[model samples]
Target: MLCLGAADTGRELCHACHLELPWLGSQCRMCALPLPNDGQLCGQCQTSPPGFVRVVAPFRYAFPLDSLIPAFKYHRQYAFGRLMAELLVEALHDAYRDSPRPECLVPLPLHGRRQARRGFNQATELARPIARALELPLSTGVLRRVKATASQQGLPAAERHRNLQGAFRCVRAAPIEGRHVALVDDVVTTGASIRSATRTLLDAGAGQVSVWCIARTP
Candidate 1:
């Protein structure tokens, strides 16, 4: 396979690995899943309101699309983050046609030790571009993971919420007060982490908190 970076490839991204992924697709607007290329909210979201006001996932976390995520997340290929973020900005435009916009964007924070070892926060890297595109303040430090815990993978989906209980805490409330803040993350496997994050923001007095992830495992 030709490398995406090679001059002869002449491709912005490697088609063999993944195409230019659409961060915003014809998804159930509430869940961010591909619909029949139409509508605002899907049947599921319309029936019941999720804890979050809205969830906007640009892509389904599958196939070759999943590969590049780990490349940037685990190995620090920061450029790929730019692609993910741009797609998310598109998703945001599609999601908020009628609703008022958020005041700021916050990246899902990593615990101190995990970040110290990994040397960076993957979510923060991905959030940077969207924050700039939206002209929204990025306040990651406001919410933090006080505890470093097990990977969400391999856990039962029902137990996911319990596992993440109290995992997040808000250090400062000023940034989010009465603001429609959005949470940025690389993926949403179980929705537990984002729930915890929303809990933190709500506790900190955020008027509204929506989740914007690159991909969702739905």
Candidate 2:
């Protein structure tokens, strides 16, 4: 679907275009950061691990994904969002084949002002189909972005973490308490946002937290 070319195999994205996608290879076991080898913790994770247990990402943040994510996130391109979600669904199937599934999926919540201005939350849109495909409950009210912080783009990792400090709060503790929850986002760049959200959920009594994103920055 990305190339608008005929798909002989009946897939939305043709084989040629699919081959061009920046698929993630070996990665850190925790944050899914690209690494030379797989199944090992990265230095960052070893020194100061993220609040989440692990991250599941299928693609690197490059090329077609870099372009496609922006269009879907900022240009209101719902078709592109759906396509990415479908790809994530397939990844999640393999990811959870031997692992325990989360009790619920929570999309990274957008601040009220941002959601109002955008008319939709891209993370929620991406998580909806994944939740349906995985047979997991989608929980939107579990977390809320209380502080409307500055854009994280271009900010260093430390600054990004400071920017999102206290930005997220678990409004409904009943559903999250002692249950494994997966946080969903379209893309994960330094993972500061995910860490902050996971911290909030854990503080709210969640037993464990995992991250699910379509792409991770290399």
Task: Write out the backbone clash pairs for model 2.
Answer: 1-12
lDDT of 1 by residue, 168-213 (tens): 9999899999888888889887677887788789988999888988
Q: Write the per-residue lDDT of candidate 2 for residues 1-218, one digit (tens) a residue.
A: 77789875445888888778899999999999999999999898999989899999999999899999999998999889988998888888899899789999999999999999988999999999898988899999999999999999999989998999899988999988899999999899998999999999999999999999999998
True-structure RMSD, every candidate: 3.6, 1.1
Prediction 2 TM-score vs. true? 0.97
Highest lDDT: give the candidate number.
2
TM-score of 1: 0.82
lDDT assessment of candidate 2: 0.92
Spell out the clash pairs found in candidate 1: 23-58, 26-35, 27-33
Candidate 1 residues lying further than 4 Å off, grouped into runs, are: 1-29, 33-49
By summed lDDT, the worst window of 10 consecutive residues in model 2 runs over 2-11
